[model samples]
Target: MRQKAIPALETLMSAARTIGNPYLERAKKAGRKIVGVLYDEVPEEIISAAGAVPVLLRGTGSDGTELADPYFRELTCGYTRHTFNEILNGKWDFLDGAVIYNSCDHMRRIYDNWVRRPVSPVYSFIYAPKKGGELARRFYAEQIRDFLHRTEERFCVTLNEERLGAAIRLHNEKRRLQRELYAMQKGRRIALTGTELLLVMMAGKSLPVEDYNALLRKLIASLKSCAETFEPGVRLLYMGAHADEPLFFETLESEGGQIVVDSTGFGEQSCELDVREDADPFEALVSYYFEETPAVPRKFGTAPARAGHLLRLVKDYAVDGVIVTRLTMCDLWAFEQYMLRPVLEKQGIPSLELETDYILQNRGQLATRIQAFVESIRSSRGS
Candidate 1:
């Protein structure tokens, strides 16, 4: 059965590759509706259901914060400023419509500015609640429903509960297969590289869920049958803000480290437990927020809880060291690094922190630093 699944999985990945700006190119050529979704909101399924392609706008793949300084103040997070500048520069002019969510204060302000300033083909603000409370849930559900209503009106499409449920099921299956793949990493049976996994995860943002799941199942089966080829390496647990590229992990692998577990959304974002169709769908969304690991809106209690979560991964996977990667100007993860470093280090665990951007242009410098760190661990063990 495992061997049989491989062909299907490859096909699925092929389909996912058609999404994002790459897919937009084809959509434009063919004259299909292209909707750009802001980070982490507007599920890919929703856009698919609307007869439009959803491209996640993660901002420019550039370094050097100076490029964004003129538009946003120095205090603003780099991610926000870069995304805003991308819009100002017409980098995403091809988009037919955009869904922006108030995920953070910075994002909220960006949305406001986009509305006042004339940019993007079409735009809407999808309000997101900041707290976990009954009021917040009600507000968010209403907002999602309103957003759907507006999208339907604008695009001349109908969105019903049945369609939403189907989308939910499809996404759920994709996530299940991804979880299974991560589980294989936990046992070191697959020796899955981080770059490979990141590609798979990003593919999820735009691919048809059913097709993506099919590919993952096939990939997992292929790896299982070829388990004998897998080589043992230093088990690693990764803790970081979103990784810019998979090259960081590739470099680590070159230094004899295999990432056995990761605490970021790349590994666990889709792991939110399944939702029941019988229950109110809105309730399921709220439940998802609570059940998912590394709950967002990082408050005081959540930081220590996240650290404890990392500690468990260390023990469970026999991790040799923890690699915490922070995007240059991401304050949340920066604060997380400051807070969690001592906790992990005090346990007598070795750790390395790397600052990086979305592009791999600086791979030469990064490779040297990674090699040095890994070699130091090897020397310590030898002594």
Candidate 2:
């Protein structure tokens, strides 16, 4: 039964890699609209309540940004550039509408470009609060309310309390199942690699919430029943930057380092906690997004606390080393890495920094660096 489930999990990964997922295609056939989400922090529950499927518009590994050069500056992050290029090249023309959140300056610039050019028929820019407090929470709630109102008006649908409750329940199940799957990585011997886990998490958001939840339940059960342990080299926790592709993880592991956990949005930050089912759904969403989600921009000035969080994961996962990856020209991750270096060094944890774009143009250099890093850790262990 466990062997029978591998192909099913691979199907979801393929759907995620494909721009239009199976559920989204089926929904379009039935005349349901698709809402493209720019960032992870956006309340997808709101989009679902508006009778639309929320699909995260992430970077493509094989695409270039040459067409997007005229619109954005030379130093624009590659992920943003590639996504914009896809829009300009008519790759994402199927999206009926888009909901963009102010996750960072690059994302906001993408939103600005879309507003100036108008890719989707309808658009909504949501300003997520950067800090946690009463005022921030209330402000976030108002933003969500506005988003819900605009979506309903655009789609001509009424998202009543009952519909909203159902959406919450569906999304909450996705989160719960993801947490259970990730829990398999807790001890020294685990069932899945970090790359596999990252793809599963990414694909979970790509498909419909109910379908993702069902598929995840099956995968988790298969992993629990399987007895194989991936005994690679030293255990490492990948920190910093958002990676939509698994090439980086593959490269790191190729050099004898097994990534066990990650600090990126695709890992522990991918809504492990569930939204309250009893409370008002919108308010619960606001609390879960603003209060629970941890992004680099939100913890800008507090690096020790962030590094301390990574340290806790190190202890929890029994990590031998860490690799902090930053996308070229990403100021947020760059600055965060600068702050996290000394903290990790003080703790005596081995760490390495890697810089790359969305595409794998310099694989040889990255492999060389990773091999050396892993060898150094092994040498120190023998000492």
Clash totals, every prediction: 1, 0
User: Alpha-carbon error at 64 in model 2, in Å?
Assistant: 1.5
Candidate 1 lDDT score relative to the true structure: 0.64
**Model 1 agreement with the true structure over 96-122: per-residue lDDT tens digits:** 887888666665666666667654455
Best candidate according to TM-score: 2
TM-scores for all predictions: 0.81, 0.93
Model 2: colliding residue pairs = none
| Cα deviation of 178, candidate 1, in Å | 0.7
Off by over 4 Å in 1: 1-32, 41-45, 60-69, 84-91, 117-122, 225-229, 290-293, 297-300, 360-364, 379-383
